[model samples]
Target: MSRLLGLLGGTFDPVHNGHLRAALDVCEAGQLDQLRLLPCHIPPHRQTPRVDAATRLQLLQAAIHGEEPRLVVDDRELRRDAVSYTVDTLHSLHLDFPAARLCLLLGTDTFNGLPSWHRWRELGELAHLVVMQRPDFSATDDPVLARWMRERRTEDWTDLRAEPFGRVLFQPVAQLGISASLVRQRLAAGRSARYLVPEPVWQQIQQQQLYAAP
Candidate 1:
């Protein structure tokens, strides 16, 4: 039985519960064999984080600790460059796991802005994309994104049970309001971010006193 793999890319400045929820939902709902968390070195569109690459990876490892054996943490992007590109990562993963079906998991907001990414339209042929609903976004809000989907002849996609990546699939997950930035903000304000991230990660941050004034 060939396994289906989900690639979730993000800066993961401080990997939080929401991210975990997203990955878990996508994996289980999509009938994926595994879900790999890809933490990018450079997010490109967003402001850079105060934490470095290694620490970010540490946090991710700590966050997904009790995840099922199917969930994996892939470090290729963090080791790749100061400026990361998704298409490049996708190509590399394709080569590494030729038999596994690959699908990209992303939030609805990012999915709408996919065109702004480097060579976004061509991505469809390479990987199956899962566009999930976000906690703060409404499906009826973006006419342009809707229009773009129309242009691609990708609309009328009423099938949530379809396999992603032509062999995989796109499925909806429970919307979570948490974000790494939000966790950082809470920590910075000296608030309780407990349960926001894994305890091991929180302990590591405390031991190292991360997010403190630089």
Candidate 2:
């Protein structure tokens, strides 16, 4: 059987419980052999992360420490020193793991904005897209995306194992209303993000005074 590898990429300005939970949910639900938390150096669609790549990486490591053995970190995007494009990252992963079936996990919001990404159309060619959606989530209204979804969407997990790429799976995960922005906002306002982020991550944030008011 081919190994199933999942990739969850983000700035992870400060790794939080929501991110960890979602990753673990997808990892178990999808039966991934390993799920890497990829922290991008430069996000193409969002503002630059407040913390540097090294600091963000450290926080991610802290958040995942002694957690799931399968939850690992991949820092290829940070080393690249260029705009972090999903297509480029997928290509690199394909090279490194030629036989592994790659699953690119995404939130519904990010999946909705797929049309705007660089070389977006080619995403399905490189890896399967696992969209983490709410149970009540409805189909997208965009005609182009709707059509694309119809072409690639699959409900069965077996379809992902059957092919190395080009399938889309919508998996419902527990929605924690936490966002990295929200965490940062609370910290900057001298508010506590105790349960929003892991204890170790919160400790590191305090130690470094990251995202605190200037």
Candidate 3:
């Protein structure tokens, strides 16, 4: 049987609890064999990460240390000296794990903005999209996205595992009101970010004086 692999890509400027919680929720709920946290070198839709790639990777490693064995870090995007497009990443992952079913995790906001991504139309060919539904966010308003969702959406996890790609699943995950930007702001303002991020990540930030006000 093919393994069910989950991919969660982000800048991960400081790898916080919200990310971990959502990942854990999806891993358990979807019965994923493994979930990789991919840190991008350059995010296409958002501003550059506040921390450098190496530092961000370090924080990510620190955050997941000894937490969940399945939640491992993949630095392929950071290693590549080019734009971190999800399409390219998926292609590479397909090459690496041909038999594994790929599930690309996304938040509702990211799913809604999918039309604007590089080679967005080709995404379904590479991996299944698992949109993590949050209580505060609603379904996509874009007609194109809505139609796409209607056409490919699957209510069952088995449907995703049965195929290597070309399916969409909206999963309700634990909603934590935490953002990396909020963590950075607190650190920059000399406020504590103890509970916002993993303890090791918070310690690393303090030790390195990362995101401190200029």
Candidate 4:
């Protein structure tokens, strides 16, 4: 069978539980052949992490726990400079693994911000964009179908060409509604971030005293 690889990239500040579960969902729920645990060197919009890149990578490696036999941690971003960009990362991956089909995974909040991403249009040509499901689909729901629908207006049978260029696809998996920032806030306040992230990650956050300042 042909294989498709999913790339989940983030700072993974402490490689919390929710991030791991979401990636796992992408694999099992999306029937992904494999997943590459990509930890970015520098998150563009976010402030510099309290913990450095290596530390974050270490946390990611520890959190995998082998549930995803096909999952692997990719560290090219770490080897690169500051402020990592997804387009560049994907381009490099394309060069390194030319035959593999690359798909990016993100939540609704991130997906809604794609239009502002670096070289966003190139993404449509490079690989596919997979948006994880949120709550109900409101009419104002950013409508990922536009990537195809707009093109269809110039052609016939719009619905027939639903996945043109495989630009955008949505998969709504069950996940506890939580945020990483919230987890950090709870930890800093001496509150338990129970079941929000993996046990080891929470331990690391506490032991490392991460997110305690500011």
Write down the lDDT of every candidate, Cα atoms only. Answer: 0.74, 0.91, 0.92, 0.70
Candidate 2: where is the Cα deviation over 4 Å?
none
C-alpha lDDT of residue 100 in model 4 = 62
Model 1 earns a TM-score of 0.85
Model 4 off-target regions past 4 Å?
137-165
- Best prediction by lDDT: 3
| lDDT per residue (tens digit) for residues 89-113 in model 4 | 8889888877767778877777666
- 84: Cα error in model 2, Å: 0.4
lDDT of each residue in 1-214, candidate 2, tens digit only: 7899999999998888889899989988988899999999989999999999999999999889886569989999999989999899999998899999999999998898899999999999999999999767777888998899899989988889888799999998989999999999998899999999999998988888899988
Give the root-mean-square deviation of each candidate in angstroms.
3.3, 1.0, 1.0, 4.4
Q: What does candidate 1's lDDT look like per residue over 83-202, in tens digits?
A: 788888888888999776677887877876776898776576667777666556655346755665554433223232243353213356776678887888887877767787778888
Query: What clash count goes with each model?
Result: 5, 0, 0, 2
